[model samples]
Target: MEGNESLSSAMQERGLTQVELAEAVNTRLICAGHEGTVSDRTIRNWLTGKSQWPHPKQREALEAVFGCMAEELGFSPPARRQRPATEPESPVERRNFLTATTGTAASAVPFVGAPPQVGTSDVLRLRSGLDALMELDDTRGGHEGLERAALSGAAEALDKQKLGATQRIRLRLFSIAADYTATAAWSALDARQADRAQALLGRALYLARMAQDPVAEMRVWNSYAMLAHQRGALTEAIDSGLAAQATGITKRDPMFASLAHARTAIGHSNLGDRQAALRSLGHAREALGKVDRDQPRPSWMAFYGPAELTAMTAIVRDRIGDAAEAEAASHKALGAIPKQFRRNRALATTRLALAQLHQRDIDQACSTASNGFELMTGAPIPGRMRSLLGDFYRDLITLAPDAGAAREWGDRYRAEWSRA
Candidate 1:
C-alpha cells in the first residue's frame, strides 16, 4: 500500500478514528515534553495528501504511534546532498559534519588534515559559542536549528585536531568539546532521536575519557543514565548512575556526587524499589549538604541546585505513592525553581497536580494541571513532561468521569493540543 493507505490500514487495525489518532499523537507529544501538538484536521490532511510532509516532530509522533518509519507510511525521506570539499568555516558546515558523523555514517570518518595551528583564542571562541548554545537550550527548548549549529561547530573544531598544543590546553579543549557533544546528544534525546543521541553520547564519552577529566566523565555517565531512563532501560540507567557516582567519589566533588545519587534514586524509583530510592535520595541530600556554596561548579552541573533536587525528590515520592510528601516537595520545588527555567516549572506543576489527584482533590488537581498547561505555551515540552501531563489527564478522567471540572479540564487540554 502507499503511504496514505498504509497509515489508514494501521489506523483501521487499531480501530482509531482520525480524532482518536490525533489525540493519541498529542498525548504522546505531551508525555515527551514536546512543544507542538497535532489536531484532527492535520491528521486528515496527512491522510488525504493535502499536506505532504509533516514536521519532523509530527513525523516522529506518527512513526511512534503507528510503529512505522516515514517511508513505510508513504512519506519520502529528504533527498541527500553531497557535501562539497573545502567547505566554508561556518555553522552550517559544522552542522553538516555532526549530521554526517552520526547514525549509519558514524563508521565513516570525514576527511581530516592538519590545517590551522590551534591557539587559546580559538579555544575561547569555541567555548563561547557552546555557552551560547547551552543558554539557548536553557531558555528555549532544544530547537533543531540551535542544536545543529552547536553540534556542527563543536564537531568541526574537534576535527581540526589541533597539534603542538600544551597538554593542559589539549585536555581543556577535549573537555569543552566533550561537554558540547554531550549537550548535542541531550538535544537529540529530547527530540526522540535515540540513535543519534546514542552516537553523540558515545563520542562524548570517548572525548571525556581522553581528556582524563573525572568531572566530565561523570557528566557523560549522568547523561547516559538520563537517556537510558527516558528509554525505560532501568538497569542500564542505574548502572550509568552508579558509574557517575563512582567518578564523583573519585574526584571528591560533592555537587557531582549529589546529582549522581539523585539520578540513581530516579532509577530505583522507576524500578519500584521505594526503599532503595529513598536511601539514595538521602545520600544525595547528604552530599549536597557537604557542597561548598562558594566553589565554582562545572557548567553541566550548574543547574543542579536545591530546586532540582527537590523536584527529583517529589518524583521519587510520587512513584512510591507518598502523595502528601510528594505534594509538599513539589510545592517547594516549584517555589525554588528559577523563573527562567519555564520547562522545569511546568514539570513541577505537573507533579503537584498528580499529587493532588492522588489525594482525590479533583478540582484542585484540574486547576493545577491547567496552570501546568499554560506554562508549556510557546515552550518545547519534554517527553517526560508530556507523559506526566498525559498521565494526569488520564487519571482526571478516570477518577471523575461525571465531574464538570474534570470535563472542563479535558476540554482545555484538547483545545491546547489542537492549538499546539
Candidate 2:
C-alpha cells in the first residue's frame, strides 16, 4: 500500500483516474482562488513527484483530490526549500546534476532564508580559495570531478580548517560533494566511458560510506553494475547489481531495484544463463509495479517509464531466442517513445529488425537496420540509448553474415562506428 498502489487505490476508491482526480482538484482551485489554471504538464509533474508547488493554494488543490493528509500515501510531500537567488551555487557541481535531471542551468537559486547577496567578489573569493574551489568544483563537475580535486584540496583545506575560516563559509559543502560525486560517476557510465566512470564511482562510494548514506551508496553500486553490463562484463555486472540490491531491497524503490535486476538479467543472458535471465526479468516487472511517481527518485533514475521498460523487454526477449516475441515488444516500445529521442528509436528499431531477420523478413529487417545506422552516426551518444546500440551493433554483425545485404550492412556499421 505504500507503493504506487496508494495512488491507484485512492483514485479507485474515489472513482477517479489520475487525470480525473487532478481535474477535480483544479476545479476546487478556481472556486477557492482568484484564478485557477493548471497545465497538463504541470499536473503530470506533480503526479510524477519530480517537483512540487509550494504555494499554500497549490497544496489546497492537491488536498482536494489526493486527500487532506498525505499520510495515507505513506509520505509527507517534502517542503520546498527556497534558497535565495543571491546565493548562486557554484557553477561546477550544480550543472552536473541540475542540468541533466531538472534541465535547469547555472541560474540564481531561490529558497526560504535571507536571500544570499552573491556578488562578483563572492565568486572571486571561491575561485581563489582552495576549499571554496573544491566546493565549486564539486558543484560544477558533480562528484566525479571532486574526487581528483578533493584529494589535492582536502589535504590543504583540512590543514587550515581548525586554524582558520572554512566551515562557517562553506556550510553544506560535504553534502554537495556527496551528491556531486554520485552524479559524476553516473554521467561517465552514460557516455560509455567506463574507466573514468569507475574511478569517479570509487570516489562516490567512499564519500557515500563516509556520510553513511545508504541511499546514495546503493545508487553507486547500481551504476557500477549498469556500466559493467554495458561493457559486457557479465559476471562482474551481476555481482555488482546483486550487491546494490542487497544494500536495500525493500519495496521502497522497487522500480529502480528492478532496473538493477534488468541489468543483471542482461548480464545473465550474455553469460548464457537462460534460467537466471528470465528470473531476473520477472524481478524487473515486479519491481516496476511498486513505484509511485509522486516520490522523489534519485537524480540518476528519472528516465524509466513505459517506453524504456518495453524496450528492455524486447532486448531481453531477443537475447533468449524468442525472436517473434522480441520483435513485438520492440515495435511497441518504439511506438510509445517520443520522436525527439531519435537515437533510442533507432536502437529499438534495429533490434526489431534483427527479430525480423530471424523470421526471414529480410526486407523489413534491412530497413530497420538502415534507420538505426543513420541515428548512430549523427548524435553524440544519447544518455540511455548508447548501451543498447552497442549491444545491437555487436549482435547484428553475428546475425546473418552470409546474406549479402546483411554483410554490407554489417561492414557499413563497422566503418561508420569505428568498430570494424
Residue range 1-420, candidate 1, lDDT tens digits: 233776787889878888768755653344344643788898888888767677866766565555445556766544563234464433122122222222111223455885446678767766655655555556555444444554665665675465557677788788777888888887777655677888989998999888787877887788899889778899999999999988834357688888999999999998999999999999999988898888876555656889999999998998888989999999999989988777678878999999999999999999999998788776556555666778898988888889999999988877766432
RMSD of each: 10.1, 18.6
- What C-alpha lDDT do the candidate models reach, one value each? 0.74, 0.57
* Candidate 2 displacement at residue 244 in angstroms: 1.8
- Model 2, residue 420: distance off in Å is 13
After superposition, candidate 2 runs with Cα above 4 Å error: 1-176, 339-342, 376-378, 381-399, 402-404, 407-415, 418-420
TM-score of 1: 0.71
- Across 287-324, the per-residue lDDT of candidate 2 in tens digits comes to 88877778765434544666777887887788788889
Q: How many residue pairs clash in each candidate?
A: 15, 15
